[model samples]
Target: MDRWTWPAWVGVFGGLLVFAGLFLPAVVWQSRRYGRLSARRLLGTAALAVYGVALIAYTLLPLPSGDLAQWCAEHGVGGVQLHPLQFIADIRRDTAGLGLRSTLTSVAVLQVVFNVLLFLPWGIFARGFAGWGVLRSTVTAALASLLIEVTQFTGIFGLIGCSYRLGDVDDLLTNTLGGLLGALVAPLVLRWMPRPAELVQDRGRARPVTALRRWLGMLVDVVAVSVLGAGLGIGWTLVGYALGDRTASAPEVLTGLLPVALVLWLPLLIGSGASLGQRAMWLEPRWSTGEGLARGNLPRRIIRGLCGAGGWGVLTLIHGAGPALAAFVLITALAVPFTRGRRGPSCALTGAELVDARAVSPAVPRAAASTDR
Candidate 1:
């Protein structure tokens, strides 16, 4: 291969690795979580599709090859046949056999630095979407690079047609290391963008509510919580069964346990959502003078949600009907005060003192509101 060709292949491989690292998981997770799709995601998918097409074109298309002598003969532009083995040979020659001293030199350091910088965006986007801490981000990055290397070595044969691509394991190591470094830097980068994570304190005078309105809101909250908990519990049980025995039918289990699962999730979901969802929906949970909705940080929300779901799991194990059902009802009833008053349990847990949004000038831009929330 010509000098230019070798570098071009490297560039292509690196670009594809980075693109896959950033976009593939984004597509899967976002779709699962929100159900609602965005134009940006659509465009991203389109771009990836185009890249796939280009890879096919590059692999199947003919290209000019041979020395200047053959070209000058005017018989025809000498065409060189693409071969996978030749590409692999070239890659090995270029990257293999470095002395320890050379490996530790400035050039190697720079290479490592460049690799880390290349995947910084991947780490940032992964952390933003997954809410996965550093460990998960690093593991994900490593797996992405491994997939790319495997694809290259296999000549994209699994899906796309065979191509003249040389896969190197070193590439995976370097790429993953890069992503890990990037993950370390993501927090610092996000910190500089303060408006993206500003906490909104919802404190104000309690609005008067009719008895009917209060009753309806309570019903809605309880129903929503129960349904979510039950679904999650039954879903988890099915997963556990599937993992334990391949012949186990997940749908059958889900069908049988759903009612109990709903019973389990109801109190937790309503308890947690009453305060947080109300805030998100532009409503407040207020009582006598104590002030705003409880802070209900991410950890608290996750715990409450999981606890509600777990309540159903406990019911499943104990095989009791009356007590389990009663406990769920009791929990839901307890959450009502938190949903209603300023000093409710949720508020006490979160330390959120509400303030009037109207009184505070809007410092956050509408464009950045989603991130802020």
Candidate 2:
């Protein structure tokens, strides 16, 4: 549309970044709890967010133009079709012949078609992700359509002085029909893909530690640490200014260490045993056999942090690490993929192993274990 311009592109880019910022944590959480992250699941998550955003853009965009006061005075917003058959009649009127142009090229017909197609995803997702059937999907589609109409009627929550878009009954009818169609077609696609119920069932299955999961956890942990560092950097600047030193160097080195203490060390000391990333990815450090959830004590956490990536390794940027620090980082990073069970070098020294935190299996009697031994 003519409305999509440089500013629209910028808004889209910013929206995507914001969506990713929020969605990544949820993906990590789902992966942690579900014990697996499939390509399908990742795409599904992205598609859901994109679809919702697209609807908002399509329905509430090209915002009211010209002077608000003048536009409100003219007031071209309040319009609706309470007649359910009005759109169908309009489509019939748009057609001039039985040819392809008459059937598909009419702008009125296309607009009506788009309105119906817009909610197709609602049906697909309702069945594929949430396992909704025809009745539920219909209800959901009706409610969502109502919301869109209400948003149009309300002039985007009253930011605009008056409504600039029309609320239509035909849209409600077509969208609901489209949703019902989508729900009916869902089983066909679902027959070829993972069922929603199966995915839910997989949530309870025990999963072992893996290199990929550990890496994901660490990646999230890196972001968590950087955020902490930035916050600390800001605080340090404030303190410097308060002391009448406007040009004082910020405590950037100390900034990185606080995250190591809070996200890594503090949890071990408190018996949670998982960093922010570890919690997100469902990884936990074990201390010993039969000690289940072996979150280390304070000394162990401090020792591990200094020796591994979570500890002093993060200070490489601010403190400028020597060859020893470089080697430690390289070795620890390499050991994760090469070592059996992908154990971190820090784990070797700390006498702990990172395991799947939420993993579980049917428990046999203690006497059964003795008998097997």
Candidate 3:
């Protein structure tokens, strides 16, 4: 039980780290793939990540920490157990002369049950989340079990030098059976999860401009700037070390100017006036004239970019601008919910409108279409 508890804790902590790293990318993907976010699907995805880590922790963890040779000699088991239904005999032998209740609760019986239960989620996720058929799910589960057993048999492929845990064929059979059972009941278990086909069908539809979407777009921008800046900073530091320039460090200009220009300015000057994040979230700023139609132009796009993330980036490079930047971020964030079309400070100041990239402009009147022509 202690072994199990520690692995579960490790899985939980590792899962959180994995989710944090993947959250932005997941949001962008869900937005694009589904044309909107589904909280239920996101929760399920997170659970799957937890399960993945937990599975690895359970199968191979608590490696011989000290005196590998002594530990293996003391605790290691035979290389393999190839006999099927061996757990049945072992359970009976271990529970001999015990009452029916005691036999059912014996360690041998519980061990078999745990092995079956361990892989049950694998089948459920396969059928419910991945939408795989029973045969495919069962086969995959069996193959996965085989791989785990093989890894144990080879002592993690010779890294540990010798087998420390038994590689049991009975465990594989039980686990595959559990997976098969889960696949059979997956439809009922995951009735609320949106099917992949359903999301694909709705992919072309334009979703409303909401506050969450706006915030997500901003998050993407922040993440892009941070990643680009860090990568350049590291590269510059490495170059300095290689060239014997011990005092060389990342200049504020190189780290600050380039990422902002590439991520914000270039996009605003080009098609759609959408920053990288905005493009990822299917959002773009247009010149809103308080008329039915809104379009983008170069000058206003530049102003909008400056008033938004690009401005924030520049201020970050300037020392003693922290308070102003904080105020700008707060005001922009607050303006999203209250402003028309959910425009932030950037869009409001420049008279730019935020819209879904998929939104089609209203068809022009025949006379209007011909007049321009």
Give candidates' CA RMSD values in order: 16.7, 5.9, 4.4
What residue runs in model 3 are displaced by over 4 Å at the alpha carbon? 232-255, 288-294, 361-373
**Per-model TM against the reference:** 0.30, 0.75, 0.87
TM-score, cand. 1 vs. native: 0.30
- Model 1 has an lDDT value of 0.44
* Per-residue lDDT value at 147 in model 2: 89
Candidate achieving the largest lDDT: 3
Q: Could you give candidate 1's per-residue lDDT for residues 242-320 as a string of tens digits?
A: 6885454445345434544454433344533333223222333211223322334455554544444344345544545
- Backbone clash numbers for all candidates listed: 11, 2, 0
> Clashing pairs in model 3?
none
- In model 2, which range of ten residues has the least summed lDDT? 364-373
**lDDT of each prediction vs. the true structure?**
0.44, 0.68, 0.81
Error of 3 at 71 (Å): 3.3
